[model samples]
Target: MTGAMVTGAPETTGYGGTLAAEAARFAALGWMRGTSGNLSVVTGRDPVRLLVTASGLDKGELRPGDMVLVDEEGTAVPGATAAGKPSAEAALHARVVRLTGAGAVVHVHTVASVAMGRRRPGGIAFRDLEMLKGLGRSAHDEEVVLPVIRNSQDMSVLGDRLEAALDPGVPAVVVAGHGLYAWGADLREARRHTEVVEWLLELQLAEERGR
Candidate 1:
C-alpha cells in the first residue's frame, strides 16, 4: 500500500521462522520456483495485520527479512521493513483470513493443480481417495470439491471472486491456470493442507492417465 523498504530476516519467535523453514521445503519439492508462490501468517487480527513474503524472492532461500508487514487492505505497514512489495496475490491471502478466520495461507503453482483447474467449470471433484481424510473427511468414499475460479490480473476481481468461491470448511481452492490456495487455522495446518492438496492433485492426474 505504500513504498516498500528493507529489513533483515525475522527471528525464530514469529512468521519469519516458519517461512524460512517451510518455503525452502516447498522449493526443494519443486513447488516454488521463479518466486512463483506466496505465503503469509496472520500476525494481528483486530486490524488484520500479516507478515507476508515480499514479491519475487526465491522461496528456496526465504529469510525472515524477506517478509513484509501489511494490513488487511494489503497496504505495507510502517514497520517490519521490506525488501520488496508484497506478492501481487496478497489480496487473496487477506480475503481468506478475513472470511475464514485462517491464521495462515499458502498459495502455490503446480502442474497437476493448474491442469485440473483449467478444465473444471465450477470446481474439481475428488472422491474415493484415501487422501480425502487429509482434508478432514471421515471416510475414503467421501467427496471433496476443490472450488475453481477464473484467474485475473485484477486483485479486486480476483479477491471478490475467490471469496465467493471459497468453502471455509475445506482446505483449498484453485485459481484456474494459476494454482492452489490452501489455508488452516495455523501455519502447520496450512502447510499440511497445501501438501495434501498438492498430493491429491498429482494423484488425480496420475489415476486419470492410468485409466
Candidate 2:
C-alpha cells in the first residue's frame, strides 16, 4: 500500500488498509476476539490525521472498508467512507499519539493480559527477561513498569487520567479490568510490544499460581 498523504484531509483508503491488515493479524491470534480491540495509524503529521477501526465490527473479519478517518479531535472527516462511528476509545488513542508522537496505537483484550491486570500489584513488572530488550530496554537487568490505569466507561475522564500517568519512555499501558494499549513508531514495533507484554503477563500468572 502507498504511504498516506500528509494533507489535512483524510487519506481514508491508505490508513484503513493498514488498520485492516493489523486487525486481522491480531484477531487471528485471539488477542482481539469478537470486536474486543481497535487499531489506528497516523496518516498525517500536520493537523494530525488518524485512521482507526470503527466501533462494533468483528475484528477477525476486519476489512479495509471497516475503518474510519478522524481528525485530532476525534471527529469524523467528511468525504471518507467510514464503516461506522469511531471506537469509543478514540480519544485515548489520540492522547497517546499526541503525547508520544507514536505512529500507531493498538489495543487488545488478550486473556493473559486481562488476568494479569486484575491480579497485579500496582503494576506489572518485566525484570531480567530477554523480552524486555524488545521494548527498548538496554539490558535484561532493567525493570520496566507498565503503567496500569483504572478502566471506566467515561473515556474522556479515563483518557485524561491516563495521559497524566503516562511515562514517556514506556511504550505501553494496561487499563484495569480492560485490556492493553500499546504503540510505537510503526505497527510492527507496536505489535511486538504487545506480544512481549502478553507473554510476560502469562509467565507472571503462572508463577503466582504455583506459589
Candidate 3:
C-alpha cells in the first residue's frame, strides 16, 4: 500500500448536470432561495455516493461544479469541489437515505411549511387530499401524518429525532420553525413530494385562518 492514497473518482457528468438543473428549478420556484435549502441525489449505490449542494451557495445560482460528491456517512469524497462546506443538515439527509433507501432528498424553507409547522400544536396532518397520491399513497381518504420536530442547531440530535419520528410510509417531514424534508426513490419523485406537502400545508393554513 506504499505511495497509495485514497481518492474519490469523478462523478458522472450527467449526475452533476441533473443536480444543477434541479437546484435551479427549485430556487426559481422560491422553494429554495438565498442558499437556504439543500438538495441531494444518489449517484452510486455500492459505495453509496451522492451529489449534494454545497453549503452557503444560492440555489438559484448553482452551477454544475457547485455540487459535491459525498459518501453515505456524510464524508466528502476527495476530488469533489464546491463553493463551501456541505450543508449542516448533511447528517440528517444521510440518515433519511439510510432509513428509507431513498435515492434523493430535498429540503426547503418554504413559507407555508414554516408557518404551518409553527402554528400546528402537534404535527401536520393531511387527510382526504387528492394530492396525497403524489406521495405514493393510493387513496386520498387516508390521513398522512407528517411529523414535525423541534428545530435544533445540533445536527446529531436533530437527525436522531427525525429518524425516530418519521413514519415508514411517509415521504416527508417538517422541522418546526425551520423547513421541510422530503425524499423519494429518485430526485424527481422527491421533488414531487416536496411540492405536494407544501401544497397540503398551505391549504391547511388557509383553513385554519378562515376558522
TM-score of every model versus the real structure: 0.91, 0.91, 0.90
lDDT for residue 142 in candidate 3, whole number 0-100: 78
> On residues 1-211, what C-alpha lDDT tens digit does candidate 2 reach at each position?
2256434323334566667888989999989987888988887777787788889989888777787777787667776654679987887888788889888899999877778888873788778888778788855667788888888898788888788778777788889888999999888788888887788788888998899
TM-score of 2: 0.91
Q: Write the per-residue lDDT of candidate 1 for residues 1-211, one digit (tens) a residue.
A: 1112223334534567677678888888888879889888887776687778789889999776788777897777775564578976887788888888888888888898898887675888888877778878754666788889999998889989988888765778898999889999888899999988898889878888789
For each candidate, the alpha-carbon lDDT, in order, equals 0.80, 0.80, 0.80
- lDDT, model 1: 0.80
- Ten residues in a row with the worst lDDT in model 2? 1-10
Which residues of candidate 3, in runs, are more than 4 Å off?
A: 1-12, 138-140
Model 2: pairs clashing at backbone N, Cα or C within 3 Å: none
**Is candidate 1 or 3 superior in TM-score?**
1
